[model samples]
Target: MNEAIKGNILTPSGWLNGTISFGERIEDVAGSSSDPMLNSDDYILPGFIDLHVHGGAGKDVMEGGDAVHAIAAIHARHGTTSMLATTMTAPPEDIDVALAAIGKAVRQRGKGEARVLGAHLEGPYINSGKLGAQPNFARAATIEEVHRLEKLAPMRVITVAPEISGHLELVSDLAKHGVRVQIGHTLGSYEEGVAALDHGATGFTHLFNAMSGLHHREPGMVGAALAHAEFAELIPDLLHVHPGAIKGALRAIPRLYCVTDSTAATGMPDGEYMLGRHVVHKCMGGVRLPDGTLAGSTLTLDQALRNLVGLGLDLADASKRVSTHAADYLGLQDRGRLARGAYADLVVMDRDLKLKAVYIEGERCDLNDA
Candidate 1:
């Protein structure tokens, strides 16, 4: 977006009326305004970035096709500009196919939806004890499997159980391939979790939902996320993790991030939805088991933001949980901030926090279907 579009700039202090100048490409941020302009009526924070999102608008990223394209558009409408196509815990072949699909979208440059930086390979490499919705048959990746992914050369982030056999070596291999490793779906102790971090595990995937609860003596996976100063992913639908737990997780983990971890059930009516042959029934704000074991959420990041604000969190702080912090987890320096040099990929919202517009690579994306 050239032609010197100016608006209210949201700084850490507060909203300031200023002109944000840009260069030829969306990646360039140059120029300054001595005299500020525009009103401070709403926010101008960085756009939302979701590192874990399965699918929405009745489309599954695993289903391939235009799933990434469609889900991206729908999510952008709710305030996500850059995101990862979260893969479910599936068979090795299924995972490979899903990841290849994500690679296609990245190559084609998906339209109107959130820009796909890479794929978040959520499973086939996790502890079965905490596999809430994931199929138990799939477990942590072997050294050979990790090496195969490296050979594929696809942009991939992985979640694994640190305590699982071979995962420590897998973590090192993945990190070598530039794959971001996260500790999730695990029964790992705090010590093991910390070890994974030392080995290259950068964050946690949906920290409390599938992982073991924290204990006074044991200090399980959640304990590791809380004690370590690394980023912890949370589904802030307020159902996946309790409101009280959210507060505590935030206090425990210095960089707690919000992710949808949503399924195809999201943006669809309450009914049976397929999450790779597992029948996920949408109930309330999430998908769950018949026994009420909470599956993935159906909540949007926009609602997550509202939940944070209603919980008395500052808007900027809440926005960063999805945008800035998640971006940091993915190691994406060019995104997560609305500053001049960052990609113009952004979401504009109204006072009610409803999404008004999305700019992807400087073009205004039409989110009518979302």
Candidate 2:
């Protein structure tokens, strides 16, 4: 079935008052701002792509069953067309169970759900001292262990502390296998950070949060990222990071993107939720531990877009941060932009930036499902 929509469409070239026609893939886009029917306040943009997602709708990804499905559905309602099922630092057995579920979801995407691209192994290979909100399962990365996990499912992204023993070699090996290695949950020095990037780590996870801070002289991991990284992820919930720091990262990293790092508490009312083995409380519009250490987040990508805009970024730049750059980081050309021959994944928003409609691979999603 062919479907067509007319509005202010964002494209690679720029915004156009256009009509986009599609089925499962975008067939055509044509329009002019001078057209008489350009009075509508709606804006059509590419569907959001989140590289980090733990869970949503009261289900934790670590729970491993129908939880990933529920998480996908809820995030899709918030205009996430695709996401990686992120896992926390846990024991091998627990990780295996979670990866099995993510693999199943990736192979079989449910209706009205965001496409589960793959797994984002966020830990079990990080610094225990910098384990912010993550459990105490930090360890070194071994190719054997990584290969074993890879067999269960494709790992599109993995966060590791570069300073861990033998991880620099591991980073090179994983990068060769096409995995997107990210630096995070570490107390690595600035020199080590640059060395990791030189070896193969291409991005920073939740920049300025768990990693080391920038110092005038010491220039820690954050300094390494600020000075050299081309890509990094930020939680745009306004709770995780200050707006000023976000602006600084914006100025530093060319492809700085936004992620939820969301837990099961997302899209749910304030309450207790599971983030792996830890019990995280969602309250006051943020998720945190009992001692008030920030856990994951309750942010959705749609809200992430709005938050970016609120931080003085124009809509086009904000859209790229929440959608395009994340896709680029994963080396996906078709999923991020709305172009001819691209997947028909996009979101329709009103003038206020609230979602009016969402399409995932040409399938319209129920906005109220979350």
Candidate 3:
């Protein structure tokens, strides 16, 4: 069935006031020629594509099976049309389970759930020194292990520490197989980060969280990312980064995007939750380890949008941060814009940036269902 919705439709050029007709893809977007400043009412925009997400709704991606469905359902309700089923630094068996399950979900995504783009193996090849909230499952990257995992399921992205032994070669190999290599959880300096990018490390995971910090003489991963990395995912829940820093990143890296490093505790009440092999306590609107290092988060993408808006970004740029940049980063040509023939994955929000409705593949979602 064809469907049409009227509102201030956000397009790549700017805001358009009219109706969008769509089915599986956008059939047409008839915008009002007389463009007035968009009001603070029902605004239609592209659905968010989260490149990094762990789990939500009390289910971890490591749980596998229906856990992907649960996580997708939960995020779909919050306006994420698609996401990577991000994994943690776990043992080989655990990683295998997560990869298999994520591949299955990608092959057979159901209705009423966000599309699982693929698996983002966060790490087994990261630096143990900078493993923020990740367990002690750190190891060096090896071609044999990478091949075995690829055989199990398609690996869309993998995070590595450039300083890790034998990882530069692994980065080149992973890139050869069309996997996006992200640098993270490392104490690597600017030189090493540049080397990784030259070897095909195209992105940085949760920038400034687990990687080395910037200094005057020896700008580390953070500096390298801000200055040279092609893409970087940021946690903009306010808890992960300061507003000033977020703005700085936005100014520095035009391709910078937002990601919810959310955990199983998301959408649930304050309580204890598992992050890989460690236990994190959730309270006071934050998740943390027993030693007080910040864990993941309980943030949803809608709230992330609100945070950007609160930080004084206009709607279009905020939408780009959550949708366009991520989609482009993953090379998803079908989404992230309200253009004709794009996937009809969109979000509806009131003036206050609150989620009013969500549509994935042109099907309306029950926001209250998850």
In order, candidate lDDTs are 0.75, 0.94, 0.90
- Model 2, stretches more than 4 Å misplaced? 33-39
- List model 1 lDDT by residue over 278-336, tens digit each: 77888666698677777787888888888998898977788788788888777777787
Which of the two, 1 or 3, has more lDDT? 3
Best by lDDT: 2
Whichever of 1 and 2 has more TM-score, that candidate is 2
Output the number of the TM-score-best candidate.
2
- lDDT of candidate 3 over 46-155, digit per residue (tens): 99999888888888988878898999999999999999999999999999888888889989878889988888989989999998999999999899989899876678
lDDT of 3 at 337: 89
**TM-score, structure 2 vs. true:** 0.98
The segments of candidate 1 whose C-alpha lies over 4 angstroms from its true place after superposition are 1-6, 11-14, 22-40, 150-153
Please, what are the lDDT tens digits per residue for candidate 2 over residues 1-370? Answer: 8899988888988888879999999999998744223476588999999999998999999999899999999999999999999999999999999999999999999999999999999999999999999999999989999999999889999999999999999999999999999999999999999999999999999999998998899999999999999999999999889999999999999999999999999989998999999999998889999999999999999999999988899888999999999999999999989999999999999989999999999999998755
Lowest lDDT 10-residue stretch of candidate 3: 32-41
Q: Extract clashing residue pairs from model 2.
A: none
TM-score for each predicted model, relative to the true structure:
0.91, 0.98, 0.97
